[model samples]
Target: MKPPRSLLVITVTAVCLLASQGAATWLLVEQSRTAALATAGQTVKRTLGTAAANINRGFLQVDALLSGLESLVAPSESADPAGPNRKLRNLSDQNFLVRELMIVGADGQVVASGLEATRRHPPALKSSLLADDALPHGGLLHGGLPHGGLPHGGLIVGDPLRNRLTGEWSLYVGRAGRWKNEPVVVVAEIPLSNIAQLALPETTTAGLRVSLERTNGQLLMSNPHDARNTGQILGPVSDRLTPGGPWAVVEGRVSGRRVIGAATPALHEGLILVAQLTEEEALADWRETRRVVLIASAALAAVVVLLAVGAVLYLRARDRAAASLRWSKRLLDQALDSMSEGLAVYDANWTLVLTNRRYVEIFPHLRDVAVPGTPFERLARHAAAVVLPAGTGAEREAWAEWRRRAHEGSESFEQTFPSGLTVQSTQAEMPDGGIVSVHRDVTAAKRAEEHLRAARDTAERANRMKSEFLSNMSHELRTPLNAIIGFAEVLERNGAVPEAVRIDYARDIRLSGEHLLAIINDVLDMSKLDAGAMILHESVCDLRRLVGAAGNMLREQARAAGVLLRVMIPEEPLPVLGDERLLRQVVLNLVSNAIKFTGRGGTVDVAVVRAEAGGLQVTVIDNGVGIAPEHLPNIFQPFYQVDGTASRQRGGTGLGLPISRAIMKMHDGQLEITSAPGVGTIAVVILPAVRCAASPADEVA
Candidate 1:
């Protein structure tokens, strides 16, 4: 006899649950350790930062006191050192850190001594602080300073030396300066213990060490206080602290224990502030957290095992009676929910009998009403709003009738909703005269068809425009070449023609050649802009001068066309940074367009002024045949012409406005044209205020 299948399944499930719990416990412990290390690094940085600030502030105070002693003793004044010495003694006693203060003159002699012990005996030429054999790095010559000291007006840090009176090592700091028209050095002695105390505060904790060391890795002071380590060069000990984010962790041997730490450069030149916390101390909290999580997970796993055992007994007793029925119901529900199409059934009386989840989703308005015994007519009425909702009421009613007829005939039909969802529904007759319908959503397929149609239309339109541009280009190019060739032939083949006639033909050839060159230049300029190869040669330029210059160049063209051209630029200098030549071309192109479009006796006005949006504005208004409202949108498209026939008569490549617009965009500006059929046109060029060297208040152009 085989064991029951439910018992086998229960045993396998219990084993998997326990294994998963164990894996979760390991992950939690690892995550806790990472978080603990990150938190420890930040705490170390804060501690080092505070100690460095305090030490820097104290040294600054000592440097300031030394400056006062130099002022009291002057070489140019009456030669009495008594008053200055008394003041120095008072300064030393007042400041607890200051052991002594003195001023020494050039030629290596003491000018004024703060301690009288040095004034009386002057040990081993104490007056000569800068003896040659005792340079700062060289051995001290019998306890005297070296050949050179600090640079002018900057503090110098020197090696520790024993005080003359106390026989204890003290640090001396000095500064060189000019006092009373004489060069002198002021020096002060500060106790080593006082400097050490400033670095190591009273709140220092166990398993933590804070040290102040030279940039050369020479140890100056340590909090956990080692006496023999003073003045010892630690030799690149910072390499031991491996960087672990915002701070560092001590990895290899720095001593016996590993530490998480940070090293900060102190404000005082050539000193490093270090703060270290032992790794064991930093991980103390993480260890206890891991222990608690492990115990809780183990207890929870045990409770789940006991519950599974009780559930197995209860389920085993009823398995034979209830398993078959429950399995059938569940399998049917899953199959309905997993289907891509909605399903619904109606009885012979036309009352709703059953519906899948998708059926309620497809007809959301009837979700609450779709149940056994609800009339099918009422559900159809509720679903009508989603089917072509924008159509007339009569049309909606006709659609409902169509659906009813299709179901009666057992046929398929498609209906579109307001949400753009297209659904295909098919109804079949059952053996008992009932109906079953399946609905499938086809929104993606319908949208793909619409997109393909739109893309085809755009491609056709672009092809037509390019064809027109090519035709126009060919005619304009041939006219000039034909004239030049015809005239040159007359001059060469007919040398017997009169000299006056030949001279006239020669002039025509030159003018025709210039016209041909102009056409080629326009095409090249447009090509450069299209390829993004044009670079603006930016400089500080007067925009007013540029606009005025453009008007001058086109004055003759306007006059030849029998039109009045008015230039209304103010005399104020319009300073802007841009390519001066390109800016002139933009202004020239707009004004030329205005002049060409205006009829005889029409007016074309060009003006430069401040824009309302705190920028520069150039406006060209022409009282002539303006563009129609519908053609305004395409004016900035390359080689686009509103009236192709009118453009041929005006003699242009239809690329002027597009190139001008591109140039404006490069300057971070814009060009706008507003027009009506016969009311004339207003074309404005706006330059952003950022490009204007002068503000709107200053009347920038």
Candidate 2:
């Protein structure tokens, strides 16, 4: 019993379509009315304009004839002034259209006239000419021109002339007579019925009539049949007409229907040209156009209704399908809110349409204001929120880089801030003409990674310090122990008393005491370095002397091992500033390392040079059962030796090179090494330039 949803949807859509069609129909009707009114107005203006032009031309022609007559008799050098005036008066009488011509002298005397002599005296012409008004006022004077008892009306053109030699103007006048030679004073007596006749020729309908009126409300001319007294001058023309010479008048009725009128002023005079066409004739063609347009409009409405009904059904089906697909809408919204990352959705114009909780949290100030709608760009600027530290030019460059990548559709990217916050952001285009932005904060993750790396480096540094201390301590203690052992052996070798008992006691004491002392020294030096309490004994030293002393110190040990020992010294006295004790210790360690590694018959050499480039080089070269390629790289690492057990047997602590490296570094120098699998090893010490003031012995003493 319920209507199907499709039917209901169709019904709603049909209602909308009907409304649209009605609007279209109203628009069409309005357009037609506007067109009709415009056409009517244009026609009226065009006909009026043509009539004005014709009237102006006719008025000017009359004026031109009057000017010609005036120039023919200039009064200035007339041998007999009265005689010349008489001759001009005779000239005016010769033309049938000229009503009168008169000569009035400077003294206001009517010297001569074409009319009766008594009637020719001036009344106002003298005062009018001398006044500051425009020149030669000659047009319809309602009282008509003078003379032989008939009305004379049309136009009058007058000019005040000055003789070429004398500078005074004299008035000359000519006129158009109303009926062949008869003259009358009033302008209305001129037969303008000729003009009315010409306005509508033979094709004009039988009942139509045209007439012309003067601005004074007096009729000049009209078709004989249009004698109906219009109670007053009708329509716009008479009320608005301006006063002056040289204008025309037009007025009329058609079929005795509604009156219509238009008027225009003449070019030469202020006269108006008026025209009228009544309603019956103006609307004669309207019925046909209205019939055609109305029929067409009705047919168009029927077609639109049918098409609209079909479209309604189709659109309803589409709407239902779209409504069925709304399952994911809520889920998507919840996901955006749930994210810890800042998420925002923007419309096509980049206005922010939606922002998640994280976005609101990050930019809390935004909550106090209106929520930005539909475009992200309309919100606050991104650059205003982000900042970089000064002097980190590289960080500022990253924003420029991000903009370039964004324009190129590089949708996802990571950026790090000087505040040490790192963010990964992505841009996603939404189906509804918008973009969704997701930003994840990475500050904590980066800081944690940095902390872990620092910890590993700290552990490595501590282990190296331990091994270095052990090596330095062992070397220091063993040197004194060697001296003790040598002395003990010398005593046992004297061959006095019980030699066997002395020898055993000497050997036990020598071995046990030396080992214990070495351990004690290693532990002490390690403690000093760890506590940050190690001090340097700085003094000036001769480099050549130090190298020689270092060589001599290691020579006996080298000889005991059956390795050849050699020393090279620079001829020039090399001066340096450093801790002489550590410097000497460094040399001893290098030489000992050479000796320990050398084979029984192999050679060990120490060379000191005034290095060419403003430094000193001391190299220890040894040919032993040489180091392997892999073992050579880590040989200087603390607790790292090519052969660990063999190094112990040869009396090494495995931290000799590390201790030497630390000592050289304290003195602003470095130890470098090079080795091959079966070739001799080379250890070189390079020291920076230093100014030495006094000798080590002098300073110590």
Candidate 3:
């Protein structure tokens, strides 16, 4: 009898599954071995690349140092040989990498040396290192001219050599220049150990060896510096010697042990960096990883079939979480950018972690310097260099240090740049020992504060002046009104008195009333000027006649006060366009003030003449006790009296000069006054040339 059909099918399926799993397992193991070897090659390649970058940077720094020395050796009007020599010595002492500094002449003789011993016994140049027929011609110099040639004010890095005197391996960096019409070179010698320190990593994996070599395969540095292997060739030459070159890797026998090797050209010219690892050492970790991966693959194949549905759900959830995280980061960035104030966040390690757009705008100078992972001190130094006021040496360093310290504190402070920009910086310390800083511009606010202070001071001053004027006006008006009222009362009850006494009282009342009327008129004129309500009825009038009329009106008063009054008028009529009445009032006020201020025997002179620029000028001069210089500026202000007691004694309001000036301004003229304490005062009124014309009308009476 035949077996059941179901049992036959199950038996066939089991056989096929076993055969496929055995093939897959063998294929997976082979592929893992190849991937492991590729990973090892990549590891060595990266290591070599890093070493190359470090060496390139070291050479660049040395080139920069040599370039800086060019300016020191260049011709200067205040050239001091001893000073430059001392500076060179100081620079060499400060940099641990530099072994010596020397100024070499065109003939290759040492002119000046930083070291005292080198100065006394200068070493001769090795002809082989600087041979004319060398590959680079002048040496292995870079950074300036090609073929190792150095241009004027250019730097070059020369071939490495053993110093004849010191017996130390050194690299030469030099700058070429002409000082006092002689070709001069400033050269620095750096020891190989210093270069190694700059280019080599501090620590590396065990059994790994790093070698720095020239393009010619000559080893410049070896980590172990084995006595048997020193100065030997470093394997085969690499074709990748160009800038940004790809790293090359190879499997080779080194020190009689199979190893994986990688090589890359340093960014510096004619230099290559190589990294080597013994094959056993390099593949040890990979072998363990392979064993685990093989075992896990077998188990995973079985479990994958059972848990396929659950794996799909887990992957979907992970994708959703990743998308949400990306969205949150974008939202946070937008929120930070929306802030008006500049914001920067630093991690606990003092490295910049985040910054808003406003921060870049506020410190545009720091755009290149302030980036993620930048140290706080680096940003501070850049800020000080770009924004701080001009300072030298120690002062500049101090400013940078102060800025660094200021940033470290949580206090809010203001920083003002030389460009007149001001920013108020506030810092908050996070719970996790990080820091958040916000910078707000306060330039406009500070300016507004200054303006407000000035306005307040001006208002206070005006208030004080107004109060004094009111007090003086009250005393002046009350005195005149009191006398008029007293005299009027006496006159009204004169029926019981004699006719002569009654007449005397009447005259006294009339005089007091007139005096009061004058004071009222003066006040009214000042009020009109202040309110800008005064109008001018302009017409062509004779200035000479006006001066004569004013002199005549004040002549009697001047004589009464025992003062001499004089009028000097040009024979030709000086025509001016102005209101006749106002012009007459202006002249009258000036003449009156002159007469009132003059003492006995003092002279008051009024003159009218044709001024330069075809204008009309009127002068009122007085040989009186003149105004003090300190009081002259305020003399044109209404009710300003040089001497308040004198204003009362003279029986006149102190508005004459101010009123006159206002009328002159209305006519497009100017009133100027010059006075000395004892040398008397001179007041001149200048009318515009266009307003003056040949007029037939005489000045008003």
Candidate 4:
């Protein structure tokens, strides 16, 4: 009756193998379903969180708009009320969200309204909402308030009320403040439709529903347009709702469909945002996957029943192919990782195909989001958020869009990060229309280039100053030499010249030779000072005597120019320790310059007095055509003449002030000049009191 033992063993073995395969397949399907549900839950959570953030941001903007209206209303009583009314009207026109703007006085009287008709015949507070007494004074609002609460300074966001004038639903924002001297409230009415737009998602995904509700359970808006559901009460509050939490997942019914949903609190305490998807819709993809897997498993079972021996051979071949593929992938990854530059490749659809380690290191924030199938736009947005400075959402969006366009182009470009690293990005097109981008850090090279440019500019400026100095010196040297030569030739020739004429020629030649010698001496002194080779020949000298001697020397020239020369030396011995010759030279140069620049009948006064800082000051003041204010700072620079023609006509090289300053510096003193264009010039020579002595030592010649 029973089968043979050998046949029974084979049948038992086959049945055991088939049962094991079925159990394994069921376990795998269950794991897949669990993973899929988790992923869907996260998607719903993120979507709701983003929607809540957007709604909060919108309220913040509305609050800002309301605050701005305060300034107009707060000053209306003090200024012309008509002017603020016009301004309110203009503000309402500019902001589409603000349907109406009005100001209420301390007595709850409508002081100014944006609506012209209402302004002509100001309406009383029609809705009892504005007459609420619970509103606080002079603070910002964060949560909802009961009906009939007035807010001062702080924002009061009220529930939607039907506008008596337009017969439309509108939300009111009220801020109380003092206008002129009386208390006033500025109110802005926003249409419910506008608030709904802010809560609605920009792009709706398939099988997803979004609803916005007030704290009182009234539905303000819902996506997918269920007219019967709008303005109705929400089914129930989720037990998972946590105060101040970002978002929470819960099971609820939305628009007559039982669904898994996420709820998040918006900026306003009463406002809640909910995003939902039906259970059937959420599991649709997993169900399809399960169906396909079941069909495949049934076909494989049939094949095993028909050809069990062939199935074993096929499994072995499949294992070998998988091993080879894994080995190739490891090699490719290693090759990419070895490269110095950051490398990333995207497919023709602009979806990331692969990214090396270096790329992730350079943009570590991208590592979290840059998967194999991620779109390039997502990566660009991440970069803008992390690498760029703080900016508005729109600005960041624009920057991301620009980056996308640039990446699509063939040209190479540079991007700079907040870390101060600059990257040179180069993109190449693959044969299949994909792109490979490489980023090279070039911060050091860019810094070196900037340094080189700065050095070049400094060198060029120095070279130009040197050339100018040489040209001025050449002109100065040739003038005196030419005069000396011409006068000398006149004296050398004409042996039968009259005695007076010969004396005059000799005198002229001597003067020209003296001028030339003085120029040469000044140049040599400057060189010695620059080279640190000049030595001070210190001695005790009479300051008064020195001033008198300088005045006497320049008296003849002063007389010739019809300028009076006066010396105001103190009767008391004004003795000083310094090189007498250098002191005399400094005084002579100052006096000579004064006389040369003075007009006819102008006076040159050399006076000596005690300085405030326990020093002796010798001041040479001349009522001459004074130095211009613009040229005063550069007067002590070598070869710097205020007017080249005037300095030449004055018959001296432009080295007088510079040499005098240097001599003063060597004596541990200072020389200062102050002058006005039309007024006279005052040159003060301050010598330290320590340098002064009661008596003169053997003075150097």
Candidate 5:
């Protein structure tokens, strides 16, 4: 290429531009690579860490289960040697994960269980109970035993159940049971496979190779190993065993693929647990990042080349540039001063050379303290006097640090003043040994945050008070209302009472009072719940008892209203954990509402069904007048009714569903209502299942 008139200018511009572009490109490339590596490492760390954390959590749950086992098996608790107790039953009922709970004595005998009798003793116990090597040592023991049914996968959490006063190993035959032949275990199992299921739900790595081997170099379980390879040596056991050494983390090429392996020794067992991920698979994220970085670097280089060409042409064309430089300076100053943030300029000696209007506005105290070209020490002293005392100790130190750092060339810092104002200060060192500093206010943001916090606290407190007041009021009012309704019914049923007057007066008194009480009770419960004073007392209760009681109580009302009332309880007893009284009330309310809303001769049906969400569902279906679309939302509000006057005539407090909803929630349950404008409404109550049927043996011979 022929040399141009501005060859020197072109060369200098190109060098500077290329140097800056190269620096930017290198920074971008390194940042992308570092970020990808960080993300991949974090994914692996969290996956493994969460699995280990869950395993530890399972230990806690096992402790709780074991602590109560002795009491469940005591002779006083269960007369039959293998019969269950309330506590043991609570385990199966309250916890859904436990397919079967059994207390294995020191001798490994199956003492008590939660499964049916036929399956409970089905030739499974002969191995663990008879074999010397079968008793689990404790911690997490993963594998199949000679149980021979669906894999008897289990975790053995070996904690000694002790007497409260004696501090002795109270390992006794307490509780046992089986359900659905699902893999039953002691406590909970936190297998790597299960952890992978949660952490990589959609990943095909589920089928990836994994291995768990004993310290003896024998494989316990391995995805790549066959059944015959289990407990068989693929490598020398002694060489593989680290034996209380630090966990092994190895990365190397294996089978033409890079693999990362991490191994940790089991604390409870001597076995070593190992995890491996192929580097090609793990680092797949790097390819796309590299591609983007290369493309960006090429584009940046092209831009710098074009900029250099333009600067070269301009340099020769701009022989006289002092006028342009002076104009640029005036423009820069005007722009800085016009900005909202405070701006000030200082010389190398820390003297104030320039101050914008905002600078003067921010530091009013410095208005008379410092004149143009005065030393900055005057302004610093004024700022410290105005802001230091109002700051926290750290804030004050941070402010002091900013000034010190500012005294150093090219340093930038920020600080919060005593007026609840945050100020960000930037220092730009000038070529002539001067500095420019700017301050921007951030106090509005701080005030807004404080206001939001105050509002949130106020709302939370109000809700708590409302719930507490409601619960307290419910307790106080129920007593007298119960007496009034009871006496009224008794008098109306007596043969001695005059029939004509007794029927009219008794009906009116009982109906009016019960309706009023239901409303009062509902309002009180809502308040109590809002106040956080309501507590749920959960226990296993028969679904039949709840449905039957509600049906019987509402039968007369249904008949009087010319409505057909029917209840369908499962042949198998539905067991749920909840307050019996509250549950019964919920059923009664739904049924009663159906009866009241149904025109004469309408039909109302109630059914209890077991649900997949580990709960019993009580559904009340009715062919009544049905709710209006617009009124559905407000139907559950206190004292609200679709037809207020008509609902009054029907003698309802409108608090029924709302109170029922609150009670259901207390039990970790909820009430759902689905209604059609004319077809009818179905109210469903969901309660967590607490009772699992005692295995067949307890029921049969």
Candidate 6:
């Protein structure tokens, strides 16, 4: 129920201003409002009169023409229908206001259409004119016609009708008479837009809602040519307009808004010309004048308040400054004597405000210049020169600027002095926009931490290596070894074993021996590559045949894993100057790894194509449970696995990719593997163009 705090304050302030000015200011505002409204009312009166005259003048011409038509138009249809129609057409064409003219018989049939008569749209006379036996010769000249339309001082006006053929609206004005003792009617079709044009003033004025309305407040047409507003029962403000009475400006509400309006004496019976100006529009100048005066009054009051407030603030600030000075001196003395840490303070401009004795002792070279009111850049440059004695002038200056920026920015950082002592410095912001920084020696603690960290890292690395080797080598090497030994024992111990069972045991022994040899060979080959002992024995070999051989070796493995392994190669020989043995090993690794990782029903494609880089390449792509992005970068590192667990179902020492890439590098080739987790992987083996035999342009990237 209470007023807003700001509004209440504003009200009190305005009341005070008004009281100081007395009643003169208030009376001036009221007078301005009255003058603006009176002016608007006068303007409305003039415009209303002008519009009324314009409308009446237009209709007077129509009246004179209709009066002449009454005798000219007779029952000529009985003799020559086309002859009468042609005469009426020529007459209607002379006037821009009229649409068309027609003569109808007593039966309401189109006796003659001046334009055209068709079965679809006959210009039949509305029964309102035919049925009515009016008192006057040309019917009620200005009374509303029984059909529809604003009353006009002319022949009887009928409803505004649309020509069905042309889709044009017109006001039907008819003159009824008996020609040769038979009833006949003369009708004039008038365009509604023409009537609206006549009602409008030649020059328009803003903020005026000008329209022609019936005496009963029913709108006939608006000067703005609003067809939708025609026939709308106007507001009560329009009811105040008397068609044949004296014109007066009145204050009233129209269509939910207050307006100043005036009307003219009857332009025609049941018709009045009205013009309205909204209250907001009428009082616009008054409102502007009131705003200026109020603003001036408020400004004067504000000047007084501001002066008083300024004095109070000034006295308080002086006392606070005196107290702050005393407090600062006491703190400085205590910090210099008691504090062990080096401390410095700077103002907002990065000028040295104060420093404790400990700070000067820490950087004795800067002792002379580290004083109050010294720009921090000088002290910082001196400190940087002491810290970086071997640095160039440009480098030292850059260090000084950076340190100055850090001090002003209130940054916490670490630095080492020329004495080789590491200092940890921290900054705090003062309430007056200054900075306070404290520095403590941390050299001894940092040294001890470094030693502990080095020892811990060594111990951890030893433990990790021991665990990986023991877990992976023991499991990988032993599995096939144990199988070979066990299978051999089964055949050796059972001499009475069936031939089929003996053959199976021998086959299992041979398979186990091959798998074990592969694991051992990979380990030895990687060791040779790491020691820089492995070399490519370059020879011209068919790369296509080599890829097919690798595919054949893994075809059964792929089938067992429920993955399709497809090999595509050119029929023509693809000769490459590479170590065929190492190259085969590389392809075997890539294809086997593909099968190992790919899920059931997935596919692995191996294709040989010419490299765009001018050699031949073997592309192996697999839709697999792929290596994650984080692991792809390091996948060619020896013994690296995305999941390094020993119990993982997939078997590998993770040396295959590393050894394969090493062999490719020796041959001046590239082995790239790109993959995304849960999608697929693509491995591209590119042999450099120069290494490709017979042709330099036999490769793809």
lDDT: which candidate is best?
1
Candidate 1 clashing pairs?
A: none
* RMSD each, Å: 19.7, 25.9, 34.3, 34.0, 37.0, 21.5
**Model 3 clash pairs?**
none
Model 5 agreement with the true structure over 55-157: per-residue lDDT tens digits: 3354345545654354444555336644553345567566433334554432333344554441344223323222334344421112333354432223332
Please give the distance, in angstroms, between residue 579's alpha carbon in candidate 2 and its true position after superposition: 3.7
Which runs in model 2 stand beyond 4 Å of their true positions? 1-340, 346-438, 443-447, 450-501, 504-508, 515-519, 530-532, 538-540, 571-577, 625-651, 691-701
Off by over 4 Å in 6: 1-466, 644-647, 695-701
Q: lDDT per residue, candidate 2, 1-701, as tens digits?
A: 35457667667776676677667766766676556544554455555565555545544544554443433544455456565456555765554333345544333344445445323434334332222232234332233334444323334323223322233222223342332122212111112333443443333432233444444443333443244432233443455333222222223332434533555555543234555555445545555566676687678767766776677667768766655555467677788888899987666776667777887665554564326663243233343245443435566466555543562353787766555567777877778767777778877887888998999897896687567646655665666577667657766676574778676767667766865564465445545655766688876778888989888877888999999999989766777887877788788878887888787999998898766767788999998756777787777665564554555556545566766787787777889988765687889998876633345444421
Tens-digit per-residue lDDT, 208-227, candidate 3: 67777767766767665533
lDDT of 6 by residue, 490-519 (tens): 878888999998888888888888888888
Q: Is candidate 1 or candidate 2 better by lDDT?
A: 1
TM-score of 1: 0.54
TM-scores for every predicted model: 0.54, 0.34, 0.50, 0.41, 0.32, 0.39
The models' CA-based lDDT, in order, is 0.76, 0.57, 0.73, 0.74, 0.59, 0.73
lDDT of 1 by residue, 126-210 (tens): 3223343422332122323333543433455555555666765566666665455556667677767777677666653556678
lDDT of 4 by residue, 634-688 (tens): 8898766776456556655567889899999999999999998868899999999
Local lDDT at 295 for model 2: 80
| Candidate 4 lDDT (Cα, 0 to 1) | 0.74
Candidate 6 minimal-lDDT segment of 10 residues: 134-143
